[model samples]
Every structure is written in C-alpha cells, then in structure tokens.
Target: MTPAPIDIPDEIRAQVYVHALAAFPAECCGYLVGARAGVVDAVVACTNAQDQGAHPTHPERGADTGFVIAGAELLAFARAFDGDRPPRVVYHSHTNGRAYFSSVDQDLASGPAYPVQHLVVGVADGRVTEAALFAWSDNAYVEVARWQGPREGGSTA
Candidate 1:
C-alpha cells in the first residue's frame, strides 16, 4: 500500500532546505520529530561531525564530507522527547547534487535503530530540485512519498 503524502509549511520547508544547503561541502544531517497533521512540532538539528567511528571517513576532498549522527546526540534527542512527540522522521541534505537516498543512507537506516521515515533534500545550482521521503520496512528503505515546501532567499527569478 502507498503511504500518505507528507506535507510541510512553505516557510518551514524553505528553512529546512536552506539549512541543508548552507552546510554544503559537508553532509548536513538533522531530525524532525513531531506530531502528525502535516505540521512540524520540533525540528532538531543534529551534528554531522564524525567522531565515534560511526561514519565512513573519506579523504577530505574539499567537496563531499561524510555525514554522521553521533550515538550520544541521538540518545539525547530521544531523551529530550521523552515520548512527547517522538521521532517521526530523520532528515538530511545533499549538497552538490539532488535529494535522493544513496545506498549509504539506506544501509545506515536499515535496522531497528530507527523505525520512522527519512527525508532527503537535494540542492543543486542554487535550486532545490527534489525532496524524497522513505520509510524503513521489511529490511529496506521504501519510497513512501515526496514533498515540496517553499522557495527561499526571495528569488522571484
């Protein structure tokens, strides 16, 4: 069965997309945990710095950097929620390209670690091309739905 579409307010979507883009050259990853009804309850920005050997280390090519969400940070985020809204989705941005879940992303999310949705935002050439949403099920990342929020930086062009 197909999943319901995910929706984000224009303003919030723009902000999230911009944040992902701003962290260019390095993977920008974060969490958006909130209650449903097509609105965001809280958007928590997680650190992408790999320090605990969780993320793949690549030669700093000054272009792409591996994204890592530390264990402590994840735990802290969960504790912070305390069953309030609960983690609804994990979000990340792809700099220098479009928003599509790579194999690495799938591998990382494929487990009981997180039983929620994943949002990938792709930014390219000053244009936010696409945003894809996935859910971890049956030992794989299944494409649930796609979303479009709003434009940022006030470009009428």
Candidate 2:
C-alpha cells in the first residue's frame, strides 16, 4: 500500500530551518502537524532527549536521539487550540549532512511507542539544508514530503 502524502507549509519550513541552524554542531528537534490528506500546519519545539552521543566516537549524531513527549506538555499545547485534533507528527534535526532517516530513526519510526508521522531536519554549514517527512506502513518507513527552500527544491511524494 502507498503511504499518505503531506503538505508542509512555507512558513513552517522557514522556522524549521532557523531552528536547525541555531542548533548546529548539535542535533535539534521539533514536531510536525497534519496527517492523511490534510494540510500540514504548525511546527512545535520539542526537546532533544539525546543531548550527547550514544557512542563515544559519534557525539554529534541526533539519530540516536531518543525523543519523548510528556503528556503534560501535550495537554498544555492541546488546550491552546480550538476543536479536536490529534498530535500526529513528531520531528527532529540533524546537526550535519543531508536529511535521511538513520537506522535509529527507522526503529523509532516503526515502533508502536508513538503513533505519528516522523519529520527530520538537516543542518549543514550554518544552514537548514534538508528536510524529510516519513510515515510507517507495512512495517517499513515511507516518504511523505520534503521541504524546498530557496536554496533547494522540495519533495512531496
């Protein structure tokens, strides 16, 4: 089966880029909104649970960054908005290189621990270079959409 498509708005893309750049040399993290055939709206700042490297040799890898969203935090965020909506997207950033879901990212993506879409941001040379979104289907990871800024093109699949 094909994975659902997602549309990331231009404004959120800019913010994701800024956040990723600010956390350069270290992994940055955040969350995404929207699911199925809906408009992707809002990008929330999230904690980088893995502040340090999982291994001694790779200290800058945010792929190993285990992300957790506290219920209280979600509840607080939920109350501010009107109507009923589920927090169905999770995001994070890579301090260096392109945006691709790492092994650790895949594991987390497919895990039942969080029922949401996964978004990854890549920061390189003091800029937000890449962005990719993914969703799990049939026990595997599938691409959703990607960010396209003035520097690079966007991907939506």
For residues 27-52, what per-residue lDDT tens digits would candidate 1 score against the true structure? 56787766744566567778776523
Per-residue lDDT of candidate 2, residues 1-157 (tens digit): 8677556677877777777777666676766665444776777776554664344466554445654445666565455344354456677777655677777777765664556667778776677767888888778778778764346445452
Q: What is the C-alpha lDDT of each candidate?
A: 0.65, 0.66
Q: C-alpha displacement of 102 in model 1, angstroms?
A: 1.3
Q: Which candidate number would show the highest lDDT if scored against the true structure?
A: 2
Instruction: Please estimate how well model 1 matches the true structure, expressed as its whole-model Cα lDDT.
Output: 0.65
Model 2 off-target regions past 4 Å?
A: 34-37, 52-58, 62-83, 152-157
TM-score of each: 0.73, 0.74
